[model samples]
Target: MEFSVSDLAVARGGLCVLEGVSFTLAPGAALILRGPNGIGKTTLLRTLAGLQPALAGRIGLPPEAMAYAAHADGLKATLTVTENLRFWAAIYGTGGVEAAITRMNLAALRDRMAANLSAGQKRRLGLARLLVSGRPVWMLDEPTVSLDAASVALFAEVVRGHLAAGGSALMATHIDLGLAEAQVLDLTPFRAKGQGQATARGFDEAFA
Candidate 1:
């Protein structure tokens, strides 16, 4: 499926930070969002994923069609690697838990509890959730955090496989995972001018 955003506006801490943002992500493609911190990448992604409403503009794709992965690993502390994947698989009504575990090199630690896993291991497990989601569109926020060089390469291969299978990924990150084919969208130009401080709770509340 093709995903698009046009003239989009989003707010954080009740303040408009991004406006006139536009982009299209086609099947089997990837788009990297580039911008400094506090530029509303997370806010825009949250709006697109349906966690929050867009202040203005349009999202061409339904939120249910996309699977979102945030910087924090959304894992159950008591659940093992395999258990976590199975839980997500059940909710998404998707199978292939075993394949996802293997693809992420988690077979060795499949039985280990999430709380027992290292930071990098937890990150790997979190990303594996994207595969079992079975959604064509992936909205990832800094998906490479806590990963070593070798592990980064491994995740890159997994992403390649997803694109090969006709899926799409939209990521906001600073690291280059060697995805030279993925297009970059710099968010600086679309920044909202003279935005106010976000006093209300939102993504930018910390900056208030």
Candidate 2:
């Protein structure tokens, strides 16, 4: 399976957010979208995931072949951790709920309420849902937002494993994730010419 965006444009409040954005992601590959804040990285990911309407261009993916994890954890505040997973598993049509919970180191908090978990814990739970969903493409926005160093490492490992298993990912992150062969797309160059400037160097500089 593959995901591609062609000449994409998105506007919000009558202002252009992204224009002429294009990329193709293949199985076993990943791309990191980087830029200054408000450059439309999150909007691009959301448009690709079909969560937002595209003003122009196209996003191609198989039916139900993609899964998206937004900045929000989207967890049920009133449900236990296990209950939350079970609910998502049913939506994803997967039966390995227990295995996923274990993989995320959430076994100890199985019966704990999701509302009571820390931010990092909630993010981990969100990541764990990807494993249980069995989707071929993952679109993650700030997957490591509140994660600690160890949790970030764990997330990197999981991403590596996903690529090794022929899955693809599109991620937006402010911090570096040590993944060999990962492609970086710097969106700063495409930002409005005179609006503001990105202090960081280009993608090549950042990756090199």
Give the per-residue lDDT digits (tens) of candidate 2, residues 1-208: 8888888876444455567788899999989999888787877776777765666788888659998988888799899989998899999898778987877789999999999999999999888888878899989998999899988988888889899999998999887889885899988765544333322321111100
TM-score for candidate 1, please give it. Answer: 0.94
**Candidate 2 lowest-lDDT run of ten:** 199-208
RMSD of each: 2.3, 6.8
Clash pairs detected, candidate 1: 13-198
lDDT digits (tens) for residues 1-208 of candidate 1: 9998999988887888998999999999999999989898988888888877777899999767999999788999999999999999999999999999999999999999999999999999999999899999999998999999988999999999999999999999888977766999999999998887662445443321
lDDT of each: 0.90, 0.81
**Model 2 scores what on Cα lDDT?**
0.81
Candidate 2, residue 149: how far the Cα is off, in Å? 0.7
Candidate number with greatest lDDT: 1
How big is the positional error of residue 98 in model 1, measured in Å on the Cα after superposition? 0.6
